[model samples]
Target: MNKSAYIKLVNGSAQTEITLAEVKKLFEHYQHMTSLTGQQLGWDYKAAAFPYTMEEKEQGGIPYLLLNGNQTQLYHYLIVGVSQEEETGLHYIQIVLPEQATHGDLAKANEFCKYLAKRLKGELHLFNGRIIYYNPRK
Candidate 1:
C-alpha cells in the first residue's frame, strides 16, 4: 500500500477551498524553502513538469495535479491528489509517498505536510493515520 498524508479543509476556515494552480504554487514554495536551507532535496521540481488534468464528472474522475520525481537524481516519485467530499463538500489534499521513499524523504514529507497544514489552517492526517490540528487555539 502507498503511504499518504492529507490536509482536510475545515468548514468556516479562512481557506476552505484550493485550486490546482494554488497547489502547484504551494509545492513550488516548498521546494524553494527546502533549497534555502543548507541542504536541497536533489530534485529539479521546475523541470519535473507537474501536470494538471481534469476528467469528466460523468466518468467518475476528478481534477488532480501529479508531481513526478527526477529519475536521474535517483529520487522516488510521490503523488498529490485533490478531492472533495460529496456530502460536506470539504476538500482534501493528499500527499502520497512512494514505497521506496527514504527516511530523509519521509522526514521531508512530514515537514512539507506540516508546512501545508499551517498555511492552509487545516487538519493534517499523517501517513500513520494520526491527525494533527494546525489551527490557532481558542
Candidate 2:
C-alpha cells in the first residue's frame, strides 16, 4: 500500500503570491467538482471547527483541510503549502497526502490536484517525482 502521494506545481523563475482570491475560487471549484459539502471537509487549524464552510473563513492565507477526520488523523487531509528552491527562491505549490493515506484518499487528492494544476497553469508533479502535466510550447 502506498503511504502517500503528492501533486506539486512549480511557478517558474518568479515567486508569485498565492492570493486569497485564487484560493477561494479553487475551493469553490473543488466543491462544485466533487459535490462536497461543508460537513464533508474542514480546515486543519484547531480553532477552526468541523462542519465549517469556506464562506465562513476570511480569505488571504495558505489553507489546509481534512477530508473526514480530525487533525490527529493526519492521513485524511489536503495539504496546501509552498516550497522554495534554495538557490533561486522560486516557489511551488504542493498538495500532498498524509502518511497513512489510502489509495481512495490519494485518488481524491489527485483529482483536486489535477484541477488546481490546470487552473494555475503549473506542472503537476507526482510523489514519485514525475511531471504529469505541463503546457508545451506552441
Candidate 3:
C-alpha cells in the first residue's frame, strides 16, 4: 500500500496542511542547495537517513518531534524547530511518523522540513534522526 501522512507547517501561531509531494520536491531543492555548499567547503555530498518520532504535547498548539533513537530502536528521532508564519516571527513546528520507517520515508520527511524551513527562511535540525545536511545557511 502507498504510505500517507498529514503534515502541518507551523508558523507563528498558525498552522496549515501541506501535501507530501510538495514536501518531497522541497527536499530535492534542499539537497541541491546542500550539494553546492559541500563543494564550496570541501565536505561530503551524501545525506544520512535516520529514524524519528512524533507526539502531541499535553498542552500544546502543534506537535513535537522528539529524538529517541538508540541501538534497539535505531529508527527514532524528532523533527522539531521554529518556523515563520504569515511573514511574522518564528513559530514551532513538529512532524511525526510511524516507527521503523524506510529511507524513502525519511527522505520525504526531510524534504518536507527542508521545504518549510526554506520557505520561512529559518534554520532546521534533525534533533534525533540522522541527517547529513551540509548546513542550512547555504
Q: Give all candidates' CA lDDT scores.
A: 0.67, 0.51, 0.44
Regions more than 4 Å wrong, model 1 = 34-63, 71-74
Best by TM-score: 1
Taking the candidates one at a time, how many backbone clashes does each contain? 0, 0, 4
Give the per-residue lDDT digits (tens) of candidate 2, residues 7-95. Answer: 33344412245643555567666656444443455433222322124332223754444345343333355455555557765446665
Model 1 agreement with the true structure over 47-112: per-residue lDDT tens digits: 433222222122246555544444524445556677888998999888777777655446656776
| lDDT, residue 119, candidate 1 | 85
The total of clashing pairs for model 3 equals 4
Residue-level lDDT tens digits of model 3 in 44-115: 552432222233232266433444443233344434433335664434344555555545555656666666
Whichever of 2 and 3 has more lDDT, that candidate is 2
Error of 3 at 138 (Å): 29
Against the true structure, candidate 3 has what lDDT?
Answer: 0.44
Please name the candidate that would achieve the greatest lDDT relative to the true structure. Answer: 1
Q: How are the candidates ranked when ordered by TM-score, highest leading?
A: 1, 2, 3
TM-score per prediction, in order, is 0.69, 0.56, 0.34
What lDDT does candidate 3 reach at residue 130?
42
Instruction: Rank the models by lDDT, top first.
Output: 1, 2, 3
